[model samples]
Target: MKHIDVKEIISSKEFIGQEITICGWVRTSRNSKSVAFVEVNDGTSLKNVQVVVEKGESDYKEPRVGMALKVTGTVVEGRNNTVEINAVPEGITVLGDAPTDYPLQKKGHTLEFLRTIPHLRGRTNTFNAVWRVRSVLAAAIHEYFQTHNYVYVNTPLITGSDCEGAGEMFQVTTIGYSNDYKNEEDYYTNDFFGRKAGLSVSGQLEGEMAATAMGKIYTFGPSFRAENSNTPKHLAEFWHVEPEVAFAELNDVIEIAEDMLKHVIRTLLDKCPDEVAFFDAHFEKGLRARLEELISHDFGRVTYTEAIELLKNSGENFVYPVEWGCDLQTEHERYLSEKVFKKAVFVTDYPKEIKSFYMKQNPDGKTVAAVDLLVPGVGEIIGGSEREADYDKLIAAMNERNMNLDLYSDYLDLRKFGTVPHGGFGLGFERLIMYTTGMANIRDVILFPRTVGSIR
Candidate 1:
């Protein structure tokens, strides 16, 4: 009687005896003298249903690809439920007209070729699955946090601070301003906040302050990394879901990260079994198995010292050469997850120099309580650590890293107040999508990946 979504139609077994109205994008079309058949996808189902369109004297041309339209037809199952529309359409309403030269055609397109058309890539099957899975994964994250009683906190983006403070910050600025210059005072005074400010690398710092007082908190939003890595894995701007929890130690944080990852994945697998099956068929052979393994098994965790020893004994020729103090590269991370562990692995107790200042200093004086979660295909999906709760220890560590303590007075104030041992991890949202879908490139997973060379 009334218009229905194509998704609803695909799910309907009750509409067999009646006519119905459906709306969706035109996937494909075939025209005949008296009849036309169309494959329509409403973004409700992975498969498009075939709609039989009989030509009328009104001269209504067949819908083109990328065009949005509404079709009213009778549902008669002569062939299958998918081919129930045997009669001529009563009417068609065009919501939007797509130009003839629309980018997404019915032809096969390579993933590399699609990067250039990122703005419209979501219309593709691969991207649709990726983005849909991505959206679900993010919701799963929020659901996990909220269920765990973690407050959703929005940290200031334009604040005069960079959490990592590694000098890889992109200075927020405005043109045509008097304070915009490389002169003596404007660098700090004339910026967007009337002081130097850049995008946050990790929300952990602010998240920490919130967790200390609020018990548990997480900030899920865009974070910027200025590292000039041009690989398919790295992006300048990406989304990160960082969770900080008070009264949680390094081991506790490690377990929390693993559990959170497994929870999101299991939720997706349960809810989107069809999409998971799509991934299992088209994306990777071990897609289902990999998801199962992550949920079924405990993540392998080895300290930095033990990992280095394992790396040396791993007998595999490493390009960067494994050392005790050096940071682990992506290759090494992959080796641990793909080869040694055969699942997600947490490499912890990284050298103090290689990690952020917040990680608790181990008694060894060489390593901090930092852990990185490495999945089978994606190198590093998460990075987190236990914070140094001792006020003197935090101040000493900050000074050792040459970080300004003044800018971090509020962060340190968490320690000044009643400080309990706390820690958390940041899950890279894009990398998680890459890990889940078996998509190789970070750019392919993100809607529009921001890389070193390409801004648009």
Candidate 2:
């Protein structure tokens, strides 16, 4: 009596008529005078298997929703052209019982309520589909980089310098609220790392070092930002996918980013058809068509100046006014990608002042070789820039920003020694999942979302 998976039994015809053992949590149950019908899901598939128990069956009990059950049964062609399990006498075994207080019921529940119980949300259809697509997309990311000969680098979680220069980091410390320190410097000196250290906001800095040595490298790991934003798009902790390429210009990385995204979309469409359909039918209509459209068309490309001009000329009322120097907001980004381009667009050559300190300064003196990939619905999907390879310019930029150069001495060493033209981009893994699954909130995609004022 081999235990068969619900997914296998539902997807294959070979399992029909064969006596098999299956174990899963009961999703739904209905009982009559002589027969009991229980729908069981094993987490292997979104669909549940129907287990029919006849009267006078040995150890047979009316299964309740959320109860764990093991049963031996013969598969038979059931109603509506589907297969079902006919439980043998005395074959039903209750592994675990669910109390009446079980939160999950047959009735529909809102996403808000599901967030309160992150532990049991996986059993629900919506979350089960979301997690399945997340797994496939994660694997697709690794596949894209590995096939391109990029070395996967595991960047450190704790760091001494802020990569984004935002100063919004969750500080890592051994001393907790101890008033024994003399001053700011002396306080840090007494701490574990002997200096200020915090969770990394981005892995691009160290990824550049690996890229310089290995020619190409990528990092996929947890990144933390301690911003007090309670928006759907912001998260205190999230996963980041960054790939750094040596001897590559801004345009080179843009092409790579486009190709990699198309590959991921195509892979997801192929591997997770059922889950994709689920999202399309429930979450967002035309979701499948949107994904197909992205892979079918070449992404649009425009300079930052050109994009701003397009926005300004369109005459659409925008909350944030379009300006050459100001950063593009989500509204402006969506207008460019969704309304104007009708596809993914790469906006390049942003004003240097608005971007980070490491970007290469263009010859125009006002802009850096930075690029952002914007798609419909989602504003900025990927952002990267050609790093300032020149040591003098790198130092000048850091000085202009009034940064403490000593903290980034090792990062500066990369520019000083054997520096080559290099560039890379970061893709917020959750954002990508949100885009693919049509999940409105970032919390719905991640298993345990860490946001402002909420650790659970």
Name the best candidate (by lDDT). Answer: 2
lDDT by residue for model 2 over 1-456, one digit each (tens)?
457889999988898889989999999998887888999999989889999888664555677789998989999999888899998548888889999888997568999999999999999999999998999999999999999999999999999999988899999999978778878899899999999999999999999999999999999999999999999998999999999999999999999999999999999999999999999999999999999999899999999999989999999999988877889999999999999999999999999999999999999999999999999989899999999999999999999988999999999999879989999999999999999999999999999999999998
What is each predicted model's overall lDDT from 0 to 1? 0.82, 0.93
Clashing residue pairs, candidate 1? none
Which ten contiguous residues of candidate 2 have the minimum total lDDT? 55-64
Give, for candidate 1, the lowest lDDT window spanning 10 residues: 78-87
Whole-model lDDT, model 1: 0.82
Clashing pairs in 2: 58-90
Our tally of clashes for model 2 stands at 1
Q: What is the Cα root-mean-square deviation between model 1 and the actual structure?
A: 2.3
TM-score of candidate 2 against the unseen true structure = 0.98
Scored by Cα lDDT, where does model 2 land? 0.93
TM-score of each: 0.94, 0.98
